[model samples]
Target: MSDTLTTIGFDADDTLWHNERFFALTQSHFAELLADHTDHETLMQRLLEAERRNLPHYGFGIKGFTLSMIETAIEVTDGHAPASVIAEILNAGRDMLSHAVELLPHAAEAVEHLRRQYKVIVITKGDLLDQERKLAQSGLRDLFHGIEIVSAKTPEVYARIFNAYGTGADQGMMVGNAMASDVVPMIAAGGWGVHVPHGLSWEIEHAATPEHKRYHEIPDLAHLPKLIETLTQGQINATS
Candidate 1:
């Protein structure tokens, strides 16, 4: 919330609403589906590996994850997984897509508070259709000034977003749960990075804890406004 920070970007999924929890539940179901072929631990490992391998091709979101699960099932069962198992996996993905959007505690309050003082936007990466559907269902969509559903969250991607919004890197702040996709890359692009930890995180989105001076870690969304106030009032330097 430095004086220069005219725009604040938020990550949509876990940062604003309950996302990873659904994935975790779905994963458990997936483990169950493959239990006959392999134990839970090994199936989970295989699924993780499949996800990592498919990321570049399918990108991020439920569709890609569902496909990876199918692929993993095929591999684990030597391409002999039953039609019923494949159907279950597909249904799981559909259910996830249609699941109700539940906002995290204080998410609406935090976004409302920040919107009053800043040009708040959502910069999230995932399947465009699914992300858009979630935003539409979130009931917080109108609170944001803009929404960006991107293919990735690299530094260059962020730089373009900031440029499009007419905010410089130093004049932007990114708040989200993932250190890998949300905080570090945005910080590397010269923006302030605020990390709000979600209880569960996708393994592929994990990264080393950042130690940059411009990086800040807040417990949750409720603490955001105070942190912004501190930065803007010069009570603390953004680079501190």
Candidate 2:
């Protein structure tokens, strides 16, 4: 294992940019479209269920989300949901797909500052085309040394990606808004895991706060550099 950090992996959705909020917006529209078929609360619950059921088949990102919504609509309406409602659902998904990228506060600054010291990479989970489109739109794509859009964020996956991108998981760090996907697995892979909450997250992405030395929570990415530096110093001090 290295004595200090070498690679820094960042989650794209709701970490470096606004993501969940768009999902929230589209979900709201979905509820409205089917307001007569089911109440918002029940509709949302069913939609969540559909997303969980469909995740393995469809994977992550707007396309999967859209299919989940459509599935939910058909379920609530007993396959009687109007063609218009289905059309609106498709439209909402497309709108989500094309929405302009809005970088979270201090995202660019923190990544740029960190990259000067570490091999910074984007290890986000989502559809390849949509994620690549968002990265291109975010204006920060070129700042990264690598990008890995994977199906899931497991310990083995993190270890593999970290090893491929930089040194190894032991000397790498992963930053993101989702504890389940970003923090937990990365820490489990023997690296630092920094939780930068975006205040909005998909329920499926939620995980309990881990009680581990390598796990950390920060209000936002703005604090990432300082936290990394402090951790680096701590590692140096312990080794010395």
Candidate 3:
């Protein structure tokens, strides 16, 4: 919350709102459906690994994720499962597409508060249509002054966003849930980043721990505005 910074970028999905729960629920089904072949913990690990490997290839979103889950289930099951099992897995994928995305607690309040003082924008990755649909459905879409739908978050992504907002990295801040995808790259681009962890965040996101001096971690969205206020006040105190 640098008052000097006119623009603040926020990550969509799990950051500002709820996401990943669909994947988690689907995963539970995977474990149960394939109970004879794999346990929940092992299945979870494999799914996580598969997602990591698939990120580069699939970018982000439900389509690639669904495919990955199905692929992993088939691979781990070794083609021995009955056809009905595969059909059920496919059905689960369909159900995920229809699952509703929810806004995290205090998200709308934080966004409303921040928008009054900062140029709020959303930076997120995923399939274009689904991401767009979720945003429109989120009811918080209007709270953001702008929307950035990125296929992936990289150092370059941060650079572009900073440049677009006409601010240097130090003047900018990124709020996100995923340490690797949302915070790390933004921090590398010279911005302060806040991470709000979700209970069912994607595996790839949970792999990295928050350790950078510029990186701050919070339990959930309810504390985000307070953290931003603290950050902004700290900067003010140092300058004074």
Candidate 4:
């Protein structure tokens, strides 16, 4: 893996920082905003359905999620949702957008450690302006080789990013929290996928772990540097 992997990509949201928690908080607010119309459990289910239905149209991020909340509100309320409730949902989204970037444990340190020997970049999907703002506020931006705010993390997307960096799939690795977005696609692209499970993950991003030779799962970012070293040394042994 040492000789094969020259570029390492990180996922920005839940992988590097506390992102899904804010979304969970906002979802709680959204349920409250619509409580008069339906039960909390029912409303949550509807919101998840709405988000899934809207993913292709809106892609990923707070703006899209806010829109989904609005749509779900209208649907649950039979279009009688008051304008004030919509305003509150928008405010929730604004607050989320303005939320401070809280780096996860050892996120900065892991990136710093990896960058010394490999090309490191952030491959996150979200609103372009909002993603840029988060990256700027993250304070770890300077440690990355580049940032790619993508619409989706598909195999093609991984291929393109690896190619752009002058690396092949076998020569690139993706470290992230979402198996659907970060791990599976990169593995499909023939790259290594390192899954770092976060405390909270959006239901829309969940996928069953696949059995693959190049897939790895770690508890958190702190263990990443050691994992990389192990993989690198293993590759050295195989080639030697």
Candidate RMSDs in order? 2.3, 0.9, 2.5, 1.3
Candidate 4 root-mean-square deviation in Å? 1.3
lDDT of 3: 0.79
Backbone Cα, N, C clashes tallied per candidate: 0, 0, 0, 1
| Alpha-carbon deviation at 104 in model 1, angstroms | 0.3
Tens-digit lDDT string for candidate 4 (210-240) = 7998999999999998998998899889889
Query: Which candidate has the highest lDDT of all?
Result: 2
TM-scores, all candidates, are 0.95, 0.98, 0.88, 0.97
lDDT of each: 0.91, 0.92, 0.79, 0.90
TM-score-based ranking, best first?
2, 4, 1, 3
Residue lDDT tens for model 2, 1-240:
565789999999989999999999898889889888889999999999999999999999999999999899999999998999999999998899899999999999998998898899999988899999999999999999999999999999999998999899999999999999999998889998999887788999899999998888999888998998898888878988
Which prediction has more favorable TM-score, 1 or 4?
4
Candidate 3: residue 49 Cα off by (Å): 3.1
Find the 10 residues in a row with the least total lDDT in model 2: 1-10
- Which is the better candidate, 1 or 2, if ranked by lDDT? 2
